[model samples]
Target: MKRPAPRTATTRHVTQINRTAILDVLREHGPLSRRDIQQRTGLGSATIERLCSALMEEGAVEAAGQVRQSVGRPSTLLRFASSARAIMAVDVTEYTARGRLVDLGGSTLYEESHTFALEGQDAGAARIDGLLGLVDRLASPETGVTAPIVAVGITVPGIVHEGVVTKAVELDWQEVPLADIVSARSGLPILVENDANATAYGEWHSGALANAHSAVALVLGARLGAGIINEARLHRGHRSAAGEIGFLLTSSASFSRYFTEQGDVDSTLAAQVLPFAAREGLHGKRIGPAFRAMMARCRAGDSEAEQARDEFFDSIALALVATSVVLSPQVIVLAGAFAQYSEESAEQLTRRLVGRIPWVPRIAVSDLGFDAAITGVSALTIEHARSATYLA
Candidate 1:
């Protein structure tokens, strides 16, 4: 505290920026030529060469191949030396707990999941145990990782404030030091993030919205969670819980009430609304399983089934209309188990936007499937690692 770091701040800032740019290049278009990297980064050729050499020495990158497009001399292609490093990601949701071992390139090397009751007392402990089990599995001699574990990323649903679980209503977690527990187990650095934010990061990093610089990802599942990426950086507002859009009061008073009311409805049944739209049917398919089954039955030309689907589309349109009025983001990405339902939901959202708003955010479904959370956590870990290295 004795002002011992006068020039350290500037040096650290520069280092962080350099490293961030390097990592960003590798993430965007990896397995690149040194010249290509230099061109993309706009760094001096000598500096790029030095950085690449240093990174290679650190086992963060490796020569993958040579690009021989030009006649003069082929350029050696560099790829993230994935085998040389490892990171662990823990994804905790209301219905399941999953952990993945990822390489430096964001590729998942191994994954394991478990269904555990996250209600009542030992929930937090159980989750920690599961995560430890995952680390052990990946660190064992048989795993054959060249660089071992460098960091760990833990993602959980609910309001997370600086490594502490503030209010995970679904999991009944409160003020749990999740990051500390995981760090104690791994004896390595740990990063904790809201699961929704993680999903947004994943989508922004590797899913359908990867190219968008400004986007909002609304994850609809056990609870609706929103994560916003502004100018390619995760924006965690003042309290680190900035993207809690589900709590935004909709027609049913609160999102909890809205989602709760739909608990009894089977999502699979709800999906049929898409096909029904094709036939322009909606009267009988008001909302329920029988309506869903009827929609399915209409493949043979049952008019009523088609009508129910139309009504279903109308409901989705209303939701998207509300979302558009609020965020007005460049793009809106949907990622969750429920998102896998028929294209009707996405299509309906688009169709409703036609005349509803002067401008509409492009909506798309996440393509990363199960890997989005893990991928986002890995990206966050990579950024955190760069920051820590600069400080060192």
Candidate 2:
């Protein structure tokens, strides 16, 4: 095949960037008059008008009535066409694969989950098929959704470089051309990203770290991952392995053991505490019940329960201190299952880290929960779709 002509510093490319900028502004703070857009974007009135006209014509933006003025004609207000298109997002975890259809505004239109074995010869194919099936279900006309899926974004727990999974220990994957396979099978443009980076972007885009120009998102669960955002951009290191903090070795074991071992409150309560508690005459196996029981015991000043919770917090705080020293981010958002900790536990963890580090970053917990990765991927996919020449 003949190679396509290399792109140059053309007027069209510049216009496209400007258009994307306008869209971004509207997406963030919309229902603005053209003058407001001009003021916020520092673009000429004529340029804003031209871009708005094109965007409006393409169904990417729409006039949302007009802004009333005191002494002049009302100015037309423009807003992003958030419902005009949608993107499919898939998040592959150690034990499950989750898929969701989301719009430009990060609203979930549909979501479903499938459990799969994390290791074995068929694990990889099973995950791929599960994701494809989820997309098919969302796209089916029977679902009554009319918005078209313009792109697909998949977040994997590993190093993803140019759509390939260079390594994903959790899934036993190596050098898997994930994006190519998904795009070929689903017939839609695909973007593959590291799960931690995706989660961080998700939190930055719509969750706790939205206001931070520099932030670190630590996902503490079966796997410990960190996503770094510097100057409001995801900082993927030289080899796209920037957030694999799980591999960091500690004095006793890998740093991941702090979170992956019986350190997670829910997992610990379910796997270890519950069984032991049952043997000791407190028979509750469910996480909810076990967690409540543990908290109750701690509140009553039970030494054993408090000690367990304290150790968990200490382990997490140590990891946070390490991350803070390295990144010096303005904010650190804790995500994944560990975020389900009670407010007291979270505060305790924060308190534990107060004197450990010289600089303290505002620590927050993820509100998006397990959906962070998929949401971030959806946002990324939408960005790619918006920037594509064909989409423009």
Please give, for residues 24-50, the per-residue lDDT of candidate 1 as tens digits.
687579989988888888888887887
- Residues 153-211 of candidate 2 have per-residue lDDT tens digits of 88987788999998775676788898888788778888999988999999999898898
Evaluate model 2: give its lDDT: 0.76
Model 2 spans with C-alpha error above 4 angstroms: 1-8, 21-53, 66-78, 117-121, 252-314, 342-345, 389-391
Off by over 4 Å in 1: 1-57, 61-82, 117-121, 251-319, 386-392
Candidate RMSDs in order = 7.4, 6.2
Best candidate, lDDT? 2
